[model samples]
Target chain A: MIATLLVVLQVVVATAITPLLIGVMRQVRARLEGRIGSGVLQPYRDVRKLLAKEPLRAEGSSIILVAAPLVLLVSSLLVVALVPLVTTANIPAVPNDLFVVVSILLIGTVALALLGLDAGTAFGGMGSSRHMMIAALVEPTVLMSVYALSIPVGSSTLSKIVVARGADVTRVVTPAGLLAVVALVVVVLAETGRLPVDNPSTHLELTMIHESMILESAGRDLAWLEVGSWLRLTALLGLVVNLALPWGLADSMQPLALLVAVVTLGVKLLVAGGVIAAAEVFMAKVRLFKVPELLAGSFVLAFLAVTASYLAG
Target chain B: MNPFRLLKLIARTGRIAEPAPAAPVADTEHPIPKALRGSVQVRHVDTGSCNGCEIEIGAAFGGVYDVERYGARLVASPRHADVLAVTGVVTHNMVEPLLRTVEATPRPRLVVAIGDCAHDCGLFAGAYGVAGPVSDFVDVDLEVPGCPPRPEAIVEALRRVTGR
Candidate 1:
């Protein structure tokens, strides 16, 4: 019974805090720019206002256009449910395996890109083309990074990776594991469309990728997209955080352990977000053609990680 | 990446000050906010202007002003807009399109005349091809009067509509 309760709590906490974490990054970016940013609760308010407003559909838009955001929202919810936020073993049905998690996410991305094409707008199609190019490169790197992290523990299960390393204070400091960390960081950055890859804040057509795809959607559809993006950000960051430093993840459902794990997970998620936001401030957006080289570089790191783990372990 | 270097740079140059608080909102002509409890999405229209109001509109979204903080944002389509923000004096050529855009917006729509030109045609009132104030077409819900109103005034108008 307690385990069931923790499972539900895990899902709710991760889902709810997703936007707050995004808000934190925005706030940090604003302060770094020496401006007074919106309050951390701004996402909450934005989502609330969006929910209250009526949605508008384009004249030629179809069921796909309408269903796209729903697909995005469902996948985001699935990801949060699958990711281990509190106890690593309380998952009731979703398998806690690396391959399963990555495959689920890939399906979600593919659906979103396909829906973009269904929007029937030229810009939407163009954004889909660009997004597909990036996703094609991102998938292999994400998988290889997972493989690298699992090498030392001799298991491919996501929870095992966490369980094996959670007690070790220095597992990630070694050369092979550090490569995994770097590779995953790059993958996460690319997946989330953060700076040096794609700028989330800009609407410049010549420079946009993700936001451009959803340009035709408005009102409630746009709101779902916005909230779904936040959930995706937190979900992916949660994976990276769990892999790189599984410290503080609870192995049992004791109330105190769950509480501590929840707090630790929140901190880890925010720190990762802050680091990404900081990277945004420190770097400029690379040109669109230059993105392949960036993804290629991450793939190289992922390759090296796999090579090193075998040689070093 | 050096924290000390960043601090040194910041200490040496204070952050850009907020654009002097928007020209004092002294006009009693600005409409009182309705009992709006939700956010507002604005679709900006430029019937005809010298580009002055657009510049200030940009400033209104810049870091310091951040109209988004008040639960209002600029969207790309009139279909998605809750408030149709018309700028400058409408040209005869623009009158039909302006009305159509406002009509395209969903119900519970609002009309905000963005500047003096939009308010009562401003300096362009007698210009050829001018269609006079936006009121000459659709009913305006709010009026922000300035050749180029400050970002704060624009934000204030939005706040009144959003009840922020």
Candidate 2:
């Protein structure tokens, strides 16, 4: 029963907060550029409009092509259910492992990218190929970084990470945790198809990575992809903040505490979004050939993080 | 301001055009197959990639590409897709997902390897994390080879699969 309730709550969070995350990013970008931008509710309107339209189907494509969007939407929604959206207590797991959460999201990416290829278009193939390349390089760093943090905490679960943060420490400082945070931030950007890796907004087919894959989808199909994108963005940001800084989360599973956790998560998301937006504005995208260098750097950091964890442990 | 326009302005100042949308999704319905008029379905899976091929894949169904004219459609789940469109290199991290993807597609489905990465390793060859080539994981019948082949190339590959 609790699992069901948490899943429903996750759906609500994914639907309601996803647009806000996009809105916040846009608002930050607009302010940086010294222009008024659309309200935070714009994404919401876009979704509604798309849903009201008819989905266009492609010729010569097989059944995989038609069902891509539904699976993309469904798998993404499932990630929300597994994550600690507002409170950590409601997530019932063997040990509330954070690795499990990360794995679930990774699986969703696989599904979405596959759908892109299923359309059997050149761009879909290109996009899926590019996305896979990125995933291949990035997935290990994620695990290694988490392993770094898990060492100090003595647990691999999301809730355990939170619990570790709450424990009293003399200096509230650890080398492994700090390194893990840096590596994780990079992973988040790469995974989300953001700047310095893959730009979410770029439209050039050659430079495009995420957008190109979904070029065939229209109306409701596109809307779900867009929504899924937002959900993913929010979930990544939330995971980082919640696990790294769990000061205000509901430890007791009480209603009031859960509300606090929700509000706290929102505030952190805004700040995190702002930081990411600022980074996007300031840094130019590195040359495509140089992406490996960036991934290499992440690999080194993750490797160091693992070493640090082992030493500290 | 229109984000699209703003994007244009930003791109102009930065000397970048927003990535042109991939060739519009082809919506031309397939010439109905005499043997199976409506039994055909497709499923997509990304083994690993940079995403250039993904949009062209989608464009095969949009206003321009009009894939519906060919009578084939995209399915949300593998259980429903008749053909499995596989993209990217098989990566170590993505191995389990790739397996799950193949398993998800319904039986008797043709495995089409799209793009150079799916055919070979494309730009990501020799990476520590990659699981060699996609063929290392699953059997592939059709190979669409290009950094991202043009939408027409994709259509030809599909035609071969459906035998229409």
Candidate 3:
């Protein structure tokens, strides 16, 4: 019963708090740029207005465009439910591994790309193709990064890895460990479509990558897409954070321990927000043609991390 | 990068130094109900203008004005928009796109004619290729009339529209 409740809570928080994270990041960016930005609750307001709107569908749009948002939303939420958020303890009977979670996330990306192609617009096509290219490059790096992290645990399951290494303070100090962290950070930035990969704030047609995919969707459909992306960000970042610093995750299904895990997760999220803001402010968006080189560099780092771990083993 | 500098900047912003707060959202006679009171996503259409009002519209949402705080945003797609912010006079060339965009916007929609050009065709009033005021094309809910309105005026008009 408690496990079920935790799963539900995780889903609710991902849905409700995801926008708040985006809002906080935006406010931090504005402050960094020496401009007064909107309130941190601005995203909540945006979501509210969006949910209330009547959705508009494009002419000649197929079922792919119509259903992609819902699929993306469900897929993202499923990943959230599977991944350990407040606690590392496996929920009752729901089981998930690093590979399974990664696959689920990729499915969401593919659905979005399909929606972009189905829209039949120049911008949508451009965004979809570019997004697929980025995803194809990023996924392998993500897998390699996770592989390096999972090396110490000897088991591919997320819960087991957390249980085994949650208290290992020396885990991230090694050469391989550091490389894995760097690779994951790069993947997080790329996956979230932030600066140095794609700018989320720009509305200019020529500069868009992610925005163009949903440029044709409006009203409630757009809201669902936004919600899904935010949840995906939270899930990916949660994995990165928990993998690196799994110390506070609840080892057993205890309510008190779960509460502590929640608190720790909140601190980690705030730190993540600050880190993302700094990265956005300091790093300029690279040229589109150079993006492959950046992703390739991340993959190379992941490869080295895995090789170093193998040699050490 | 200093933590102290970051904290200090946050602390200084806490003084309510910005947002000028003169929009009277608190005292508005008709409150925009909690649900609808949050944000206004705008889809700006340039029917036919010299790009003068466009600059003013940009200023209205820019950092100095910061319409974001008031929960108003400029969206790229008309489908995601709540307000059709039409600028300048409508031209024969833009009639189809203007109508298509308005049709694309979902229901419970509102239209704002920004600048005198959009209101009564302004300087382009009897010019060839002109399709008359935005009202003749689509019903305008509110009008922000000026050769080009100021950023605050635009923000204030939006505040009225949002009823906050």
The digit string of per-residue lDDT tens for model 3 on A1-313 reads 6667767766776566677778888888876665677778888778778888778887888888779999999999999888877766556565778788889989999999998988789998999999999999999998898788779878778767666666666765778878988898898889878889999988787789889999888778888899999888888887788777777776556778777877787778767976888667767789999999999999999999999888874
Between the candidate structures 1 and 3, which one is better when assessed by TM-score? 3
Q: For candidate 2 chain A, which ten residues in a row score worst on lDDT?
A: A30-39
Which parts of model 1 have CA positions greater than 4 angstroms off? A1-4, A90-92, B1-8, B14-39, B64-71, B75-81, B96-109
Q: Residue-wise lDDT of candidate 2 within A121-162, one digit each (tens)?
A: 787888898888888888888888877877776777766676
Q: Give the candidate order by descending TM-score.
A: 3, 1, 2
In candidate 3, which residue ranges exceed 4 Å CA deviation?
A91-94, B1-19, B24-35
CAPRI verdict (incorrect, acceptable, medium, high) for model 3: acceptable
Task: Give model 1's docking category.
Answer: acceptable
Deviation from truth (RMSD, Å), model 2: 15.2
* Candidate 3: RMSD to truth: 3.1
**Model 3 agreement with the true structure over B30-101: per-residue lDDT tens digits:** 434354576888889998888888999888877677776677888888887888899989999999999999
lDDT of 1 by residue, B3-114 (tens): 6787677567655436433433433575433322345778889999889999999888776777665667777667557788889899998999998898777556789999
Model 3 clashing-pair count: 1
Q: In candidate 1, what are the lDDT values of residues A1-313, reduced to their tens digit?
A: 6656766788898878988998899878876776666567777766776665567676777897788888888887777777776667745566767778777777768767876787677877887888889989998998898888789989887777877877676766777778877888887888888888888877566677887787767667878888877888888888888878788877666778878899999999999898788757767898999999988998999999899889988
Error of 2 at A48 (Å): 0.8
What are the chain A TM-scores for all the models, listed individually? 0.95, 0.92, 0.95
Candidate whose DockQ is highest: 3
